[model samples]
Target: METANSTHTGSHAIKRQGPQQSHNHPLRKDFFDSLSYWLDSPSLAYSSWLSEQKLKDSTKTVYMAMFGRFCQWLNEQGRRLDQLEADDIRRFLDSANPNLPQSRKARTNSGRQRQQYVRQLEKVFAHLSSLGHSGTNPGRIAGYERIGTGSDKPTRFLNREETQRVIQLIQTELDELRQEEKSTDEWLKYRDIAMIGVMIGGGLKVSHIRRLTLNCMDMVEERIDLSQPGHAHRARLLAFAVPAVKAWLSVQEQMHGRKLEPTQKIFEADRSSGFGRNSKTVTLSASSIHRRTQRFLAMAGITGERASAQTLRNTYAGLLIDGGATDDHLVDYLGLQASVTAQRLRNAYARSQLRPAGGAHLSKDH
Candidate 1:
């Protein structure tokens, strides 16, 4: 029996494996036989179609896994791939059995997972239609309302006061580190302060922050050049300077015992990661940056699920829009691919601008 990982072959006669026997009792043999045939042949066509569309390998892998799972489920229902109707697809998504394992049950019940399954199956069926193997793509039926995950929430950003408080917290930490006499502590804190400044002041995504090198900044001009190759947005200038960032540069130069070179990563990891004068460049991972951001947010008494590097970015966007920058200007400034995202930020900014009555009275008396 050909396993899911079996090599692709042009032959239609290849034997395909069924679901594990322990779980196969519910499925009809004929359904498995049909599924095996489709998996061995039409699935190849689906793969080819995916490649033709220039999808990444990771996307292809995800879709293939989704197809395999769908086939297994279809066999359990005594249905062939070609026999599926829009109602059948909808029913499969709607029905959730408690007898299944926790993980499988969760996957089945998840609206997001169901949506992904529907999307992938749509592509697969479209490929089958293109090959004249199927006449209809059940996945595309109108009025087939997808299960709403209800997980999405509004993005959060710091207001001007909260933003200033966070900066003060970071500045205090940096000042403490400076007196510690430990070079490592000072260097690391400086890096942290610099990272926060770049995110809040420049509105750079985590990827952009990770790729920044020493040369990206122009101290004389008080602007950072983000026009590096492979950047998502066209190269643009962010016209703000964070004093903490410059302070970090000075500390970095002193720590290195020499002037830093332009080609080196701006936020390189510490010595524990083998970052040294003669070593190749190494930047902090996105996850690491996120964890650090959360930690700092907590330290600043800004407690919320949305206090993240992304929130800082949102804060930057909010500030820009509040300052009367248009959506087009924001798209260019943030290196966004579309004005829709900028528009969303603008809307969020507008909402944030609606202050409650007596909001100033709630502040601590100085």
Candidate 2:
């Protein structure tokens, strides 16, 4: 057990509550299927912590998926898991190619992205050696690549108008449902709208919002307490209670015509089944969130803007940062997945604010 001290911004590791439990615990079974576990002891809560720490679902998923695919490939290639080395990764990076039919889904810089995955692979390799799974970290990427080999690219965010358009579209969709009772289950509209609103208002990432549990909220305090995914030291908090966000959630609860329990997911695709994913309850995946975001953006006529829930979150950051929100504020407020992630958004905000309006066209003759 771990005993942690709760600070206003983050939790501190004060002391060990008791003996460290083995990673072989049943609840965390098969958890090592993730490549990250080869680096450290497995924990079911690690994903949640990672989600919080990374603050981007796609980011978290992409790396996990990439590693998963590679490991699966290794097994098929008649290679022992322990025998896997940096050269295997290097070969994959060197010959990285997207499936021809699947190229339609290819993101920009397909080769480079695969190569970048090699870096993460490097970390996991080092970790595996530490964990006694391998004798050598043979899979590490070459040194020249780390300092920007022209393959690395940054992620993008959105603007305020774009953000408004996303919300507006979702609103329009909900309103249409209101006009013609899309389904007897009216909570769908309420749930989506409220979810988007909280996400936008708080500049929250999908993972941050998705992992939310019923017990984390304190409606009376108009705040929600986030317990995990600490970024650095200061960013980690015992709680992250935003009063404005609570207002949105409150309205959602009222519209549902029932008080929300602390144990309920604030946003549920299915509000029934006791608000848990049981044997019967269908669990939602990261892709579902992406698809829903696309639908909402298209409905709002902002389909061309971007395809992500985080885009709206970024839009919120850009809007506020442009309007004078500080870089530090944008970083924490948006739960940025990386330390430098806010830089480009900050640049966008500055560009939007500082760009001259068609230039000052006063001539000396005039």
Best by TM-score: 1
Worst 10 residues of 2 by lDDT: 357-366
Question: Each model's TM-score, in the order given?
Answer: 0.55, 0.50
- Give the C-alpha lDDT of model 2: 0.46
Model-by-model lDDT, in order? Answer: 0.59, 0.46
Error of 1 at 219 (Å): 2.1
User: Residues 227-345, candidate 2, lDDT per residue (tens digit)?
Assistant: 33453212211112233234345544654455655555555555465543351123334445556666766776665425556456555665555456555655555544353656756
TM-score between candidate 1 and the true structure? 0.55
Q: Which stretches of candidate 1 lie over 4 Å from their true place?
A: 1-62, 65-111, 114-150, 175-185, 228-241, 277-280, 355-366
Listed per model in order, the count of residue pairs whose N, CA or C atoms clash below 3 Å is: 1, 9
Q: For candidate 1, write residues 44-94 as lDDT tens digits.
A: 445555555677889878777656566666767776666565546655665
Residue 221 miss distance in model 1 (angstroms): 2.3
- How far does residue 215 in candidate 1 sit from its true spot (Å)? 1.8
What are the RMSD figures for all models against the true structure? 17.5, 14.3
